[model samples]
Target: MTGRGATTVWHEENIKRTFEWSAGAIFAIPLNVSCQHFNVSKDEPVRLLAGTNMPHLMNLFHNEDFIFRNPFRFHDRFSNDADYFRHNKRLTVRSWETNLIQDVNAFPLDDYPMKGKGVRIMRFGIAGTTYGCHIQEFPVGSRSTFHRHGPGAIVTVTQGTGFAMVWREGEERRRFEIRPGSIYSPGDLMYHGHFNTGHTTMRHFAMRGRSPKYSQDRYRTPLHDMIPFEEEPPEIHKEYLEELAENGITEAVSVVKE
Candidate 1:
């Protein structure tokens, strides 16, 4: 809501170096960050009840009742499982938002034209270690539904202020007065999300998983890309498209018709 359009603070300076910066000569910028919940899946009860009673339990986990994992939960070996990641069943990166289980950026804030004040993904790494560069802007009064990720992620506040919380069942587990420069994290299965907790608009960066530990195929599909970008992400903010194109990646994300 700064009339300054949007402000994006992502740097794709090769996912192989530290994102720390210097003022002019040499200065380590103290980046403020906090992790809320360290677990997003095992730490929470997923709706596994959807397929609990099938007599052929083996068949269920494979044919009828096996719960399909979202990109975040994709284990490295899934690619070998034909029933799930079979050659024909393999998943590719779909459009980030609408293509999958969640709504793509409903209120689009063009990361470019908006002065980067909107949502975005920042890529970073150092020598071989992992780091997060993804960022997001939550318009006032917005809220995401229940979901989980396989990555132990972090959320760093770069702009705006708001409230965020973690939960188990329908109860409010822990809450934070999300403010600019504050970081909160959701552990592996810490079933959680947030609203534009502040009366004004809210924005933050989500660090998706460890950097160097991520597998190569992880970036290829929404199933492994994590971050919940759906099957056919909407004709999104042009910045995202441009980023994919720059990475030598293509618009090959897939969709399964119901």
Candidate 2:
């Protein structure tokens, strides 16, 4: 072969290896990722992201349960590790004392410690499903401080309008307005945050599965933010640039600019 042809072959091989390496950690497909009870075919199209390689590829392969009434389905994760998400036993009738419920902010909870926290959750016997949703209303001109999810959550806007900035912690942030139907199913891990950007109180619905007090694990935490993702721990700054490229935005986010 010509030297130029050999070089081309070598470069192509390198590109292929990068493609495989970049995809991401291999997760053993869990048997029960579906939140629905229906069976799914293994032959269906599945998109497993190459790490943060394909941010647009939201859902992964193998098994899913369709939401009771919606076309969107939740994947069933049957791993022993996944099974231990604690939500049902989280709030017991007796657990409520002092006319309040514990661990729950009491927005609508009659007697929960998380009073005004979000909303009361009804139990779904099938595990790994988020039964309850909560909304934190942000008054006009107030932005939620940078924070990340303690456990994974799926969010939808119920009322009000605002902008949410999602990014790897400390990276360039991308802001999107939360409209009546704006929805996001983010990756299971990583430190991303939001901002409420509107003139009125912003209300949103979030579905968070039961997670152990320490499950998924968190590092540094402040008294106010009850989450695991920290901003000061140091992460890839390039994520911001990648986000900018991925989202097709050309302007820098002035999150810190006055």
Model 2 TM-score? 0.35
Q: Give the alpha carbon lDDT tens digit for every residue of 1-258 in model 2.
A: 001100000121122111011111122112223221111323433332211211222254223333222343223332333223222343433121111112222233222122122112322122332223334444333334344555446766545565666656556646666765577755534344444344344455455543222222211223233243233332422443355455554443312222
Where model 1 places Cα greater than 4 Å from the true spot, the runs are 1-132, 169-174, 212-216, 223-258
Per-residue lDDT, model 1, residue 227, is 29
On lDDT, the candidate that comes out on top is 1
> Candidate 1 on 98-167: residue-level lDDT in tens?
1011111222333311112223332322112233233355544333333456545667655556556565
RMSD (Cα, Å) for all candidates, in order, is 19.4, 18.9
**TM-scores of the models, in the given order?**
0.36, 0.35
lDDT per model vs. reference: 0.35, 0.34
